[model samples]
Target: MNFSFLSPVANAVLSHNELLSMQALGRKLRIHSVEEGIPDLTGVSVALIGVLENRNSVDYIGEEYDLNEVRKAFYALYPGSWNVTIADLGDIEKGESVEDTYFALKTTVSILIEKKIIPIIIGGSQDLTYPIYRAYDNVMPMVNIVNVDAKFDLGDSAKPIKNNSFIGKIILDEPYNLFNYAAIGYQTYFNSQEEIDLMERLYFEAYRLGEVSNDITIVEPVMRDANIVSVDLGVLKASEVSLKQRLSPNGLDGKEICAVSRYAGISNKVSAFGIFDYKPSYDDEMTEMLLAQMIWYFIEGFNYRVKDDDFVTGNNHQKYITLAESHELVFYKSIKTGRWWIEIPFLANVNNKLKKHTLLPCTHKDYLDACNNQIPDRWYKAFQKNSVY
Candidate 1:
C-alpha cells in the first residue's frame, strides 16, 4: 500500500540535492537529477530504511531525515544498493498504538534479506530494531548483530517499543537465539544496575568507551561475526550528534563513531544497518554534516565489501561473508546448536575456500566464545601491527 507522504513531511526531510551532492562526491550511483529522481531500486543490493515520523517516539531530530532521504541519499550514491524499498513508517506515532507498524517493518526487512539486499536502517528509536530483527531472525537461523550505543536498552522504558528497549526485546523474544550480541560504548546512567547485572550474567559481548581504539581490537571481531550491524545515535558522543531524542553526555566521539560506521559498512554481513535517535529538533548543519559524512563512509565501506565479499563453499558448511576485503576475510556460520556461531577466518590473500581445505592457525587459545569473551586476533597481533576492533 502506498502511504500518504505529506508535503510538510517532505519539506522537513532533507532535500535530494543535499544527498545527491554527497553522491557526487562518491558518485557510485547516478540518477536523472535530484528532482527527476532515482530508479525504483530495480536491482539494488543495500536497503536504507527508517521510521521517519513518529509522535510518541522521541522527536529531538524530528523527521528531517526520513526513510526516503536515507533511500535517496544511498541510492543516489550507491545505485543498486537497495532493490527492495519502503518509505516512512506510514503515519506511525509514538503515543498511538501501532503494533501493526512493527509487524509491517519486520516483514519488509525480511523480504530485503531474502532478496540478499543488505538493509541500512535509520530510525525513530532503538525499538525500530523490533520489526527489523524479527524479519531477519525468521529467515536466518544464526545472524551476528552489533549495537554501537551508550546504553544496553534492556526493555525497561517509558514505552514498550521506545528506542531504548527494542534490542532488549529482540534478544528476549526471538524464536532461536542470536549468533552473538555486542553492546558497545554504553553509559552507566541509561541502564539500571539490574540491567547491567543481567548483561554480565548473559555474557553479552561488550566494549566500554575507552576500550575502543583506532587499531580496532575490540570491534573488528564483532563486525567479523555479524551478518547484520546496527548503530544508535545515542552511542555517539553529544558533540558528534546534535540531534537526539535522548542525548548522552558521555559516549563515543566523532572519529570513533566514523570508524565503527566504516567497519560495519565494510564487513558486508550488513544485511541491514540501522541508525536511530537523531532528533532534528536539535540538529545543526555541523551535526547533520557529521551524520551525512558517517553515512557516506558507511556506503563507501559497503561498496568495498559488496564488490568484494563473494561466498565460499566448504565440505562441512557453506560460508557467507560480510567484509572480505582490504586484506582479511570474515564470515559466520552456526554450529550444532542454533544459538552459537563458529567464525572461519583467513588472510584475504587466500581463496574463498580457505577454511574448507586449508588449515589456519587459531589466533585465540579458545576460538569459540560468547559475546563478552575476548579472543585475541593473531593476524592483528602478529602481522597487522596495530589491532583493530
Candidate 2:
C-alpha cells in the first residue's frame, strides 16, 4: 500500500496496446498509471517492479533509461498456458540518495513476499541485490542466493558498496542472514585467485561458465536450492546482448541464460528474482527482446511449480535413507514431479534456524552416490552450513 515511492508507467506507451492481443500477458496484467492507481493484487501470482536507481552503478552512463522498451517487448509476448496473474507495478523513481532507493526497494519487496506474491525485479544495478536479500531478513532468517554472473562481484567489503562490490557488503554486513551464496557462469579469468579461494574457505559455491554451459541441467539443482536469484547481464556473451557497452566475449549464451531463469522460476523455494545491470541501448531490438523472453520463460516456469515443500504429506514423496561413513543421509523423491531432495539432519542439542529434518534440493545422482558409499558434496556443504546456524 506504501507505493508512494513508485512512479507509474508512461501513458503514451501503454496507449499503444501491443499487449492487448488474445492470450497475451498484457491483457491480464494490471498496469499502474497516473490515471489509475495501483492494481488490486488479490489473486495476482507475480508482480513486476522496475527500479530507476543506477547512480551507484560503477561506470554509469545513459542517465535517461527506463524499462519502457523491456515492458513493450514483454507485453507483446503471448502468455503460455498459465493460470498465473501478473501485474506491472511501475518503476521506483530514483530517491534523494542511493540508500533511499535501497530502503524503498527493501520495503516494497518485503511487503510483496509477505503477501505471498513473488516479485520479479528489473533493476538499475547489480548492487540492488543487497536490498533484495535484506527483504527476506525477517521473513526467512536463513537465505541462499544464486547469482548468475561472469565475475564473483566480491569486491572489498571495507570499501563503499558499488555494483561490483555489493556481494562483499552482504557477506560482511550485520544480521548475517546469508546462509549460502552460489555464483553460476563465473569466468575464472574475471575473478582473482584470492576471491575464488575465499569462496572455498567459506563453503560458498561457484560454478565456472564452462561447467554450466557444458551441461545446463546441472544448474537446476543449484537454483532449486536457492531462495533469491540475482542475474547480472554482464555475464552474457557480447553476441547475445550486442548493445551493452562492456559485454563479455565469453559467457553464457542467450538460450543457456534463459534456461537458468526458468530453473529459478520453477523452484518452490525461490521467492524473489532480479535481473540487473541492464542498460537500455538505442534501437537495440535484440537486447530488449532477449530480456523480455527471459522474463517470459521465468513466468512460464512459475506456472509449473509443484508442491514439494512439505515431505510430511507422506503420500507425496518416497523417502530413502542411506548410511555412509557413520553419517545418515536421507533423500526424498516427489511422486508427482519426480524432483529430488536430500535431508540434512540437525544437531539435537543445538538451537539452529533449521528444523530437525531440513531438505535441500538435489539430483538423482546424489542419491546414487550416497548408495555407492560416496557422500555427495552438496549434502556435506549444506549439512555443515545448517550446523553453524
Candidate 3:
C-alpha cells in the first residue's frame, strides 16, 4: 500500500507514452502565476492531468504518438469564456520516469490551490486517482466524493500492492475513510459478487451503467452531494472510440459518459476533479477528440454556481479551528513531492475556512504530516474519507 505507482526503472519507451512533457502540457494548461495574474472567483477550477494511457508500467515499443494533440484539445476546456477557474497538473515538463511525472503532478495541484483555484484532473491512469484524494482533503472540509465508472474498484482479496486495488489500498493503507461517498453508472460485469457485498456493507450507493445511460435521473443525487469527482473514461462503450485499453463492453456510450461527468461538475459542491483511463496507444485519433469533448463538458458544468467559490454552504459550515498546540496553522506543503511548509492562519472570515486557517500549507501531504505531530491518530482516522469507485 505504501508502494509507488511505477517502478523506479522505467524499463522501456511506452514507459513514456501518454506521459507528456510538462512544457507541452503547460502550454495546453495555460498556467499564470497567481501572484502575478489572478482570475476572479466568479467560477470554479478545472485541473487536467496529461497522463500515460497505461498504468501497469507497460513497455510498448512501436507505439504511435500522433494523438498528442488531445492534450491541447483537452486544455481548451477552461478558456475564460467558460467563466470557470482552470489549473492544469502537467506543469512539470518532461521527466525520465513515471514517479518523476507523478511528483510533478502532486506539485502542480499545490500551486493551483495556492492561487485559490480548484482543479479538474484529466487522468494519466485510473491509478493516479489516489494522489488527488490525498491532496484535496487537507485544506477543506465537507469533501463529498463521487465516482462514475464501470467497476466498483473495491478489491480487498489480496494484500495491497503497486498494481491493483485503489479503494482497498486507500482505506487500509493511506487510511482515509470514505465521507458521504456515492457512485453512478457501475457495470455489474466488472465486479465479483463479494465486491458488491462489501460495497453494500460499506454503505455506498451504486447505480448500474445500463440503467444510468438510459436515465438521467440516476445520477442526480450522487452529483448533488459530491464536492469532488474522479471519472474513469473506460466507463464508456467501445463504439467509434479507440485508444482505450482494458475497455469493457458493458458501459455507457460516449455522450452519456460526458453527461454524467458534466452533471457532477455542475453540482454546487464539486471542487477538485479527476478524469482518467485514456489509452491513446490503442485508441483512434478521433478518440482523443472525444476525450476533449468530455473535458469541455466538465468546464461547462464547473461554471454554474450556488453562491460563490469563496463561501461555504450546508454540511461544511463549521469554521476552521487551529489544532490545540499550534499557534500558526501548518498545512500540507503540496503534493507527493514530499515537501513541508508554514503559513500564519488565514484571517478571512467571510469564508470561515479561509479566516480560520488562512496561512495553511497547500496539500494533504502537509496536513497529515503536521497533524500526525499535533492531532491524535484516532481523530485523523475518525475523519477519514472512503470512496465507492
Best by TM-score: 2
Candidate 2 stretches greater than 4 Å from native: 18-20
Backbone clashes under 3 angstroms, per model: 36, 0, 28
What is the C-alpha local distance difference test score of each model?
0.54, 0.87, 0.52
lDDT of 2 at 153: 90
For each candidate in turn, the TM-score is 0.66, 0.96, 0.62
lDDT of 1 by residue, 143-257 (tens): 5567788777776644466666766667667374464567877766777899888766655666777667434545654675566677777777666554433376677777887
Which parts of model 3 have CA positions greater than 4 angstroms off?
Answer: 1-44, 57-67, 75-81, 85-103, 157-164, 174-177, 243-246, 308-389
lDDT of 3 by residue, 268-360 (tens): 566667776555653365677777777777777766544322323323222233453453343322232332233443333333322222221
RMSD after CA superposition, every candidate: 10.1, 1.7, 13.9
Task: Tell me the spans in candidate 1 whose CA falls farther than 4 Å from its real position.
Answer: 1-38, 53-96, 157-159, 213-215, 243-246, 306-389
Please give the range of 10 consecutive residues that has the lowest summed lDDT in model 3.
Answer: 1-10
Better lDDT candidate (1, 3): 1
- When 1 and 3 are scored with TM-score, the better candidate is 1
Best by lDDT: 2
Model 2 over residues 112-175: C-alpha lDDT tens digits?
A: 9999999999988999999999988889778889999998899988988999999999999989
